[model samples]
Target chain A: MADAKPETKPKKTHQERMARKKQVIDERIAKATEERGVLILLKGNGKGKSSSAFGTMARCVGHGQKAAVIQFIKGRTETGEFKLFKDHPQIDWHVMGHGFTWETQDKTQDIAAAEKAWAQAEQLLQDDSLDMLVFDEMAYMFKYRYLELEPVLKALQNRPKNQHVIITGRVMPEGLLEIADTISDIRDERHAFRLGVKAQAGIEF
Target chain B: MADAKPETKPKKTHQERMARKKQVIDERIAKATEERGVLILLKGNGKGKSSSAFGTMARCVGHGQKAAVIQFIKGRTETGEFKLFKDHPQIDWHVMGHGFTWETQDKTQDIAAAEKAWAQAEQLLQDDSLDMLVFDEMAYMFKYRYLELEPVLKALQNRPKNQHVIITGRVMPEGLLEIADTISDIRDERHAFRLGVKAQAGIEF
Candidate 1:
């Protein structure tokens, strides 16, 4: 004999299913929010790596964190970022103040600038009070042999365990990647330069 | 007979002049370093603002500072920055997860997503424990009206006195400028998009 009771199907519409799915996803995200510790390597031929690094400095300052920035091979004149941060009491901003090698053409001067900047960076690296340190265009220093790789590697290794650091420029050394908790390669597929377009104000800069 | 002593003039080379100027500059910079409490605004269209912010985040984490990020209008999928920071136990990396309205044709959905993201950001704004807060692409939100202006103004004003904040994206509102202790407008003289070149991976994104 057939059962007297009829089977009842679950009543869930497509929207309801989606809502449920979203709730589940939200819960997972909330759970994941507790975990944090990241190392980011922004590489590639993109135009904004340095800009991005500065952005972080602004953020840190806003939150009351102490930060230091060492600019290598990019100090030609006063940049907007430099001007803004130069007088800030919270930041320890240092500029090697040497233009690129192509501009300087003096091996001794370039090396001297690199050494001077590296010295400051080393000090910051060892300072436990600094919350963040930026080695702007440091990769280029190693790539161009302006600074020794071994010392940089050693400094990074020996840096205050709690101190954070950022190194930016093209062509990152493999050793950096090996030790980096996070590595990002900024790939270049297309750029405005190939089209002979000048960088626009407030965009390319 | 006139007895005239030969004039003793010290001729200075360009390098020597430069060295003297540098010495003065270094002294001024060193003095500036002693002061604290600097605020900087990294604005403009040039690339690197957000990248710099993330770089700072990495540094903060390395240094053991508590940090957080609130990304607006950049949400589509997981970004490299988000992915890198998501699982870290020390950071609070939150993405609004709604791609820009220009990219998304659905205005209704865009506004909804923006509101959701704003809710999360509001929570961060109210929190006192956050050491650094990076508000990525916030200008776009203000420009697009994805969120209200008054509340944003209020939240920023009410932010923890010592907390650091970074707001990025092009075309900042006048209000933000007035309240910001430091403001940077990134001027782009040219861009790849004008040249009809595609954004290179790692560089553009």
Candidate 2:
């Protein structure tokens, strides 16, 4: 056979190179779906921590996953999240309207509300059927010393292995940090309020 | 005598009236200035959209506002956001990286890089001098197919009405939403090769 001369290879154009890169990326994505056991914490002074949590709840619902939420200090008013998820069959949503201690000032009532909220949280933590749980502003409970960290930690550790959890607040307790698989703190460097502005609907609130 | 009779009124405990109300609803801490225009957008799918946008190089150094960020995308990675802000002099921090993005093709790489860094994000977005801007995954982007929408319309039309702008993407591209805004898209999503599953970092470049 005639010597198979080495054929020169053609160089990939930028577009072609990008396409190849995308294909390879897609392949790797296929492999990442297998891993499990994830926890998330979103803390910050900026807006949207709770919004993000609710967004996750919506995603869980899309996936046909059973999800639950316990609002530690924002139960008083009707939140957009409550309106959206409360009626959804996939989510078990609960809110503790006690608000924050700085605003509430009554230590005794704060403790009582924390106890009541924690009782509901305990049940959610025990339910293996739940694919995800969100503790909205639960950090305030620990920050205010309204709830014992030990029990919360125990509940987190004891929850079903497959269940994922999310906690949102401005203050993150060290104990929660130690237990959290993921922690996000939101820092507010420049906020609109300093300029004497008001919070707009759907943006801040 | 009439004043004495009027004095015999019933006393109310502090908790009774406040019980039905929120101790603290959303409160605006500051306002935006005419010289600055900062707005934040937070909403769906893509990871680090908000983090990356707030990781502006110029603003973090210029302003001394105590900037911060709370990431919704969970998973650890040497985020661009971290390289600039984590140890910087004028920044505060927080993070929640618990391996989100439910549809993963490569589990190991995905989990390893799940924690989206927000160091730089805090430095720039939170600075009082820098003004406030948060890309809390502002939902308008995604709802509009990265091109068009209504929610974003209202956001742009009625933000705190001023200086800083932070936008996170998930398909929001309302009619010239960036009409008077600075806009940057993270562009990269669904990465697997970046983690060396195939594409690897730098080369997946």
Q: How many residue pairs clash in each candidate?
A: 56, 75
Against the native complex, each candidate's DockQ, computed on alpha carbons, is 0.07, 0.05
In candidate 2, what are the lDDT values of residues A1-205, reduced to their tens digit?
A: 4888777888765456546666775677766543333456777665556665655554455456788889888755444346534766877878775666556858798889889989999998889888889888888888867788998898888888877787888778888777665554544434445554454333343
Candidate 2's residue-wise lDDT over B1-205, tens digit each?
6656565657756565455344233322322323435455443343334433443322332333334444434334444344334565644434544433332334344334322233344344434453445444434324423323454355545544333555565654545445433332322223322333332221111
- Badly placed stretches (over 4 Å) of model 1 are A1-205, B1-9, B12-23, B26-40, B193-197
Query: What's the C-alpha lDDT at position A108 in model 2?
Result: 90
- Global local distance difference test of model 1: 0.64
Top lDDT hit: 1
**Model 1 residue B126 distance off true place after TM-score fit, in angstroms:** 2.6
* Residue B75 lDDT (model 2): 36
What TM-score do all the candidates reach, one by one? 0.50, 0.53
lDDT of 1 by residue, B124-177 (tens): 878888766888888777787777888888987887765567777777787777
